[model samples]
Target: MTLLQAFVTLPVLLPMLGAAASVIVSPRASLQRVIGVVTLALVCVVAGVLLVSADSYGPVVAQLGGWPAPMGIVLVADRMSALLLLISTLVTLAVLVYAIDQRISDYGRETASTTFHPIFLLLSTGVSLAYLTGDLFTLFVAFEIMLASSYVLITRRTSASRIRSGMTYVIVSLMSSLLFLTAVGMVYAATGSVNLADLAGRVGMLPEGLKTVLALLLVVVFGIKAAIVPLHFWLPDSYPNAPAPVTALFAGLLTKVGIYALLRTQTLVFPQDHPSTLLLVIAAVTMVVGALGAVAQDDLNRLLSFLLVSHIGFMLFGLAVYTPSGIAGTALYIVHHITVQATLFLVSGLITRRTGTVSIAQMGGLAQTAPHLAVLFAIPAITLAGLPPTSGFVAKLALLRAGAGATPAAEIVAAFVVLASLLTLYAVARVWVRVFWGTPKEPLVDNDPNDELVVGTARSARGMYVGASSLIVVSIVIALFAGPLSAIASRAGDDLQTREAYRSAVLGPDTAPGGPGPVPVAAVPQGPAAAGGGAAIGAMTADDAEGTTSR
Candidate 1:
């Protein structure tokens, strides 16, 4: 591998390797934390490098073992993918710090010592790989990696509630996975390829009947993951039951992966003439339904969970429009939401920790008890509501402005988007008034139900404070630097909308536009390449070949 290829692979390679190493050091809490932090920090730096490189030099790809295209596992880093990678690692690192310092890990216990760090690192690896991979099956593998880790993480404390929710989460995820795998089968059965660039080259030639079926199939699968409206019922139930930091991590990473997948497949694999119409309907309904759900929630965690689902509609609205300005706005909104949502949840964690309850009905006067926490909560709450002087406002303006050009449909979705923002403001404002502004409602006594979860409140650590605050600072920075970030997002949007650069980058220069045809998958490994690579073309995957079965 060339030196640059090494850099391209580092973000994936380092974290999985670190996760493996973490197991050996699991007996030592300090050492395990060090491994997890350093691994993510390095991945962050690598992701930053890839983001700059992709923005400056165009997309970069590495084919393992120096093999070619669909024949080898390829990792491609484009501006969009790298941008996602950077923010994911940042959130992962921040959430990890919070978990560690909150003493939530219970390090000396075997389960805590053995499971948390390894799964945590593995989860980060999954997010990075999901963003970076070039093929559908590889993306599926990455999703499974994420799912396995998440299953363990969500059920960590083994409460009945946790197990029940985890079961729900798993069933939903498995259904998505099964749909995704089925879609992959359809894609390969139809086009003889699962590599995204190859699929992009060939999908345009497919019968509209097949294309529409494939498009809807992929949308439903990803919709389930992104928590878009009707499919979002599982999220509010599942997220709040996990540990605070774990929930924050889920808020930050998981659903966004689904959104990212939707964005990728929409632009690359399923950009048929009429798909946007359905997307618009989904976006509008998701915004209205999610915001309505948030309006009645008294629990802060569940409330944020609903808002999380609601705001995905904004990104979908941008995608539904499917224009450059629309996508750039979506991209910016995504970066904004990831940080802001995670920060809000982390702040929620702090609120639950400091105030002895997440329910505002019984919670009051937290500002008097933890003034700094009040300010911390206030920044993200206002920002999430799309109030002025924050990145959320910038994101909302960009989406609305983009919507203006898309006419009556975009305009309708835009209205829902605005309504959702107002509802979000009201919901968050209620929490502020009831919890932080009023006098104590019940005196936070030892026997209080809220106090049951507030162990070690007086001794709260700096890591929890600093981790949540750092992301808030990031949200502010994005707001302040909206102009430059918009440029990057615009460039990324251009790349996604224009498939030529990605094709050429992943499949070599001959795969550029105006090609006779996509460089055939068989041709990828024909010269001085593995014979089995060519033989594998248009075949069922190994898991399929081995007869995958539920039981």
Candidate 2:
């Protein structure tokens, strides 16, 4: 493999290796923390290099262990994967730093040694693998890796509530994985390949009814992960109960992976003349339902969890359009949301640390006592609400433009998007008003020695602030660089639509240009082919053989 290819792969490998090393070495607490930070820092560097290299060299692909495309595992980094890798790495790094400090504060030096470092690194590895894998089956494996690691992290404290939440999370996740596997099996049965590029080529040839069934299955599988509407009951229950940093990471990265997979599959594997209209309706409902849930929540973490679900619908709206602008909007939204959401979660955790609770009713006057924290929270809150001069605004604008220019049905979808944003703003402002502006509802508690901990101390708040602020700064940077980023997203969307570029990039230029080769007009069955041996089966097998020969 070349140097660029190595850079592309290292982000995933570094975390996996570091997790194993952390377990075996049994390092000192400080050393374990160092291992986690340094390993993630290295991943950040590698992701950055891959981003630059991919921009200059175009998409990079590596066939694992010297095997060829159709037979071998491939790790491919296109503009989309590279962009997600960069964002996810940054979020994981920030969360890792915050977790390190939070552990020290909450558990002190003794028990901090147990599982945080190892599990977190493993989680990073799983996320990285999900973004890098080039095919469907491997993506499923990556999803499982992430799900298993998350289960351990979520239930680490072993409280009754935590255990309950963890069980729900595991059950939901396992069912989704099984659904995904079944979808993959169906696709493979129809197409004879699990490689995404190959599937893209063959998907258009499948019968309409079968395609619709496969598409619906995929939507359910990924929707469960993305926390879309009816499938999102697990999110509010699971996320708020996990440790703060774990919640932050989950908020920032996990659902976005689902979004990524949804976008990839819909755009690449099933690009038909008229895509699923039902997805548009789902998008609208997801946005409205999620925002309404957010509005009703009084607990800070639960509120944000609902907001996360709501914003996921916006991304879905962009993807549901299946146009270049829609896809670009979705990409920009993904990048912006990761940083902004992680920062908000971190800041919320900081509030909980200071006030001893996340219930907004129990907290007040934080701006007076924790001015910096209030400002930190405000930055992301405003951005999340789609305020101007932020990446969030850019993303929302892109979606609005796409929606306005889309089919007449999209105009209604656009109205829902606007309504959702307005509701989101109100929801976030309610949190702001309750937490930062209202009169102190509960007296400052200094009786317990632990409660007497000073606010704004370098030791207590610095690490958390640094982590949150770093992501906040990144969100601003994305806003400033919006033009270039949007261009990259547009190109990525274009590549996804005309997947010949991706197929050639991965499978080599030898394959026929428009896609393997078109099925002969006479070969395509007008209706269902016969189930048992007959002329229809013979024709189907002959068609498959001919297509393979052309390749």
Candidate 3:
């Protein structure tokens, strides 16, 4: 294997190795902190290198253990994977620094510093692995790795509430994982292969009935992970209770992974001749429902969680449009959302740390006391509401343009998207009014008297604020550099529309050089008719819908 390939794989491997090494070498709190910071720094460096290499050399694929594609495990880094990896690494590194700062105050420095480092590194490893894996089975394994590590991180302090929330998170994640496993098993039984490239090649040949079933199953599994409307109940329940740093990472990275899986599997593996109107309808409802839930929430974390769900539907709208513009918009939205969401969560954590509560009703006039915190929160809040001069604006514009050009139903989808953004604006504004604009309801409290030396010291909360600001700055950077980023996104969308690029990159160039293979003939049930009363089954063509093609 080439040195570049080895470098690409180390981002995933280093964290897992670090997790174990941290546990074995020394349980010293200071040592663990050093190890965690160093390990994540290395990861970020590797991720940066990979992104640069991908930009110049195209996607990098490494056969695990030197086994070739289609028969052995493979890790591939395309534009999409590379971009997401960079975002994830930045979020992890920021959170790690914040965690180090808050270790003693939140959980005793000894326990918080040691336990968190190992689990968090493991979680980072799993997230990286999930993004890079080329095979469906490896994706599942990565999902488990992430879920397991997160389970520990969520319940790190083991409080009653933390344990309860962690249990809910664990149960919901495990059930989704099981459903995903079942779907994988069924797909393997039907197609005789679990490789994503191979599955993409064979999906069109499967009977319409089985194809519909597999697609529906996948939607359920990914929906659970993405926190889509009805399936999103667990997020508000669990996210607010974890450590602030853990919550930041969860808000920023985990749900996006689900969205990534949905986009990857739906568009890449199961290319359909016609777009699924069902997904379009669900996207609309998800946007409206999630926003309404956010409006009802008074807790800072719960509000952000609901908004996360609502924003996901915006991305879904782009995916539903099944156009290059829509896909590109979704890609941009993913980047925008990750940065904005992480910033908000970290800010919320700061609020909780200072005021000793996340309840909006119990906190007020934070802007006066902590002007920096207020500014940090404001940036993400405005961005989340899709205000101008932000990446969020660019993302929404792409979706609106796509929706305007789509069918009549797409017009309604566009309307819902707009309304959802407005509602998000209202919700965030309400939090602003309640938490920052009013008279101070209570003074800041230092709960740990023994830690007086660090209490209100520059090192403790400053690190948290710095982490939050760093992410907000990234959102601004994305907005400023929208031209180049949009160009890359457009190329990604174009590549997706023509699956040959992806297929040839994953499978060999000789395996269907120009387009996907012929459609398969396996039999399964079909979904209900389209929303406009059109028949679900109709004439098929290679380029009839986004990503659909005859093998």
lDDT of 3 by residue, 373-488 (tens): 78888988999999989889988988898789878888889999999999999999999999999897664454444421122232345676677888888898999999999888
Q: How does candidate 2 score on lDDT?
A: 0.82
For model 3, give the RMSD to the true fold: 6.6
Q: Name the lDDT value of residue 138 in candidate 3.
A: 91
lDDT of each: 0.82, 0.82, 0.80
Clashing pairs in 1: none
Q: Model 2 over residues 328-418: C-alpha lDDT tens digits?
A: 8899999999999989988887887778677788888888878998899999999999989888999999999988988888879989999
Q: How many Å off is the CA of 536 in candidate 1?
A: 15
Report the Cα RMSD per candidate: 5.6, 4.6, 6.6
C-alpha TM-score for every candidate? 0.91, 0.91, 0.90
Give model 1 RMSD, 1 decimal.
5.6
Candidate 1 per-residue C-alpha lDDT over 348-377 given as tens digits, one digit per residue, 9 for 90 to 100: 887776655667787888788789988999
